[model samples]
Target: MTTAVDTRQVRDLAVAALAWVSAHRGDFALGADALTADGPVDLTWKPLGELAQTCVSVRRCTPPSDPLHACASDLLDFAWQQTGRGELFLRLQRTEPFATYPLEVYSVFAGAGLRHTGYEVAAGAVARSRGWRLTEHEPTRRLGLLNAERRSGIHRPERFAQALGRTWLGGLPEPWTFERTSGYALTHVVFHLTDWGRTAQDVPAELAAYLTDWLPPWLDTCLDAGMWDLACELLIVAASLPQPIDAATLQDPWRRIARVQHASGALPLMASDPARTHEADPEPSFVHGYHSTLMLAFAAALTQGVPV
Candidate 1:
């Protein structure tokens, strides 16, 4: 029942989303001293990381001549200037349970920002090294660590490959399910294995086989549940597989997502449903739509192959 993705529609949605972020860049900014409090720091990290991911993906899909290219570049520069200090690490160290799962989460996106922006942060490097040292004690975070390294372009292939070899993906808790956190983790593993779709040939045969068999059902389950963010991540996984998945299978989800995007370019966390509420609070927080919007941008860039 699925149809081919309308490439024009995808591009249009991406353009709108980028324009929204550009216009609201001020709201998304992480002030130099913004990490002074726990609530503020956590809020700042989420949107900043999301925007950085979008910027990187947008850059991949377009040429320098594209209008979005300058916006993405400028935004990354501003983000780097804001958080490149040791503040992120300082905040992490003071956080509860010293080596918590949140540290791994922050590392994954922060590293992605660095890798995509090509901005060098000596402080970030120190923080990542510190985080890596901490993660050695948490086996549950192995996949997270691998994702951070790969996305940040700081990976050790032999070590990472060995880690992947030892992992029993099927044995992991609800390994391939559509639950948000764990599901994202699973997709991140596939992404790292494939080098974010840049080197599909590098995907391990076992993992690729597993995804080949399971991804379709998983994608269906996520869409059925209206888990758009996770669905987008799954789309990236499907696209990165060594043998391409049929584009038609992904078209429906893409169109559904585009239809739900607000006029301001922000894609909602979920599609329209009378039971769901979609308005921002009195003080509009950028975090509300950050993930879905970023995911849409990433998906569009990946699908539209960058101009040569």
Candidate 2:
């Protein structure tokens, strides 16, 4: 007999998580080598993109009166500035014209009404080439490129549905086959399909039905394993469906997550992890913690209703 999740608790969790992210914004800054092809993109660009993307969801969902709205807006502004007002993206585009990452990162800002005409013109020219259209990517990667193109207003010949069909989730694979990597892949599949939950209706009926059937057990598995990041992502998937799972069904996971969340709103990568080192080893903490925290905020925002 589960109870409904407290709306106030959800809001409070989001507030605290955003507070943590805000305090650690500096950790997301790019290193001097960030522009080089061999730079540690996972640490620098990836986290910043995730931060900006989650902030976009927060601002989109929360009302101006909500504290989250202001906090997320500030963070989004900071993230944009970190990219040197989109100049970094332009530079990356020039150096790695065929790379999909910069375009994908830029698309998040683009969707939020941030634009860099110079980047777009250059990206557009490259994207229109036969090589760009013909390049092969993994199913999930292909979906990402397609979504980035859609968000950035870059026309591509590929259809989203066609690309989606090639994905693991699109195949509607056996539910028992779910694993760590597949879990992330499927969540991303949903993320792309629904535009990070902004357009839940975009989820095809069959895929939504598949998620509705399997997501509860998957959520339980992640939480039971103390995989906070994956659990939060599953929650986002749950909320992104056309008809979201019941709040009651989510009570236990929410309670477990709340218990582990620090007073400052940061969460560990997994259960009973090391004591946080804000000074000595902030990178590990920031890289692992930010995604889960941002996911929590995004899930909460979706539950609060983003007005479509």
Candidate 3:
């Protein structure tokens, strides 16, 4: 029987991947600078394709042989400072040699400050520490036809723990994996400003969209519904609105992607079609956070037009 891996080992493996990618920031054979203002890394923003490329590159470069060796080691040391001895690895074996990570993921990470100080420092740390173990809850059966269609080969998402010594303000996790965490924090800043009676112009365009399209419906469905964790997703989306939010009430912009679950357990937003929703996924929370953050960021960009 194949042995299931432990969480710490998985963490280490993940750290290794981030190190490889970080050290190889300019090298796609491991890590290539993922974000560029004008275009995709490979000039094609396809994530599936990028994964294929990344897998091939990583497989080809071993720890000792790769120039990123020292960088990777350094990252691990940093990681150990936070979480201790985590193991990480790709969910899939490297096979296709030509695939590269899509620029969007890289762009998203970079735009969100994945590598800079106070950025997702946990990219390496998480990959180094975290705890987990397997348990048998139910029988499993392979999805042959469905799996074939999704191209969803089994590659586990890179997960990890906070490194030990590094302390961020307000006890926030570094390199937050889900965009929702960061988005919500940013959103609260905007909300308090808006609720406290701040001017719309004071806000960023990145957050503007949410003021209309995202806010009301989110409040309608998420708050009214009992699903609280998903609420985090909604808060994050709020962060992406642009400056000078358009005059809009909370109810106007909901695409009504799912049924609203207010006052009870039913969520209308949840029932809506995924494609029609702002972001496509099992839950709209993540998509909501993503779009909100993006819109707010765009608003920040508009400031560039002004004479500094």
Name the TM-score of candidate 3: 0.22
lDDT of 3 by residue, 66-185 (tens): 433344344333332221111111111122111222211222223212223221232223222333112111110011111111122212242111111121211333433324334344
lDDT of 1 by residue, 199-272 (tens): 67877777778777777788777777667778878877777777756777677767766656777787666644
Report the poorest 10 consecutive residues by lDDT, candidate 1. 275-284
Give me the runs in candidate 1 sitting further than 4 Å from their true place.
1-3, 32-34, 37-41, 84-141, 146-158, 165-178, 271-285, 306-308
Give the alpha-carbon lDDT of every model.
0.61, 0.85, 0.28
TM-score of each: 0.73, 0.93, 0.22
Is 1 or 2 the stronger prediction by lDDT? 2
Best by the lDDT measure: 2
Error of 3 at 125 (Å): 30
Rank list by TM-score: 2, 1, 3
Off by over 4 Å in 2: 1-3, 272-284, 306-308
lDDT score of residue 107 within candidate 3:
24
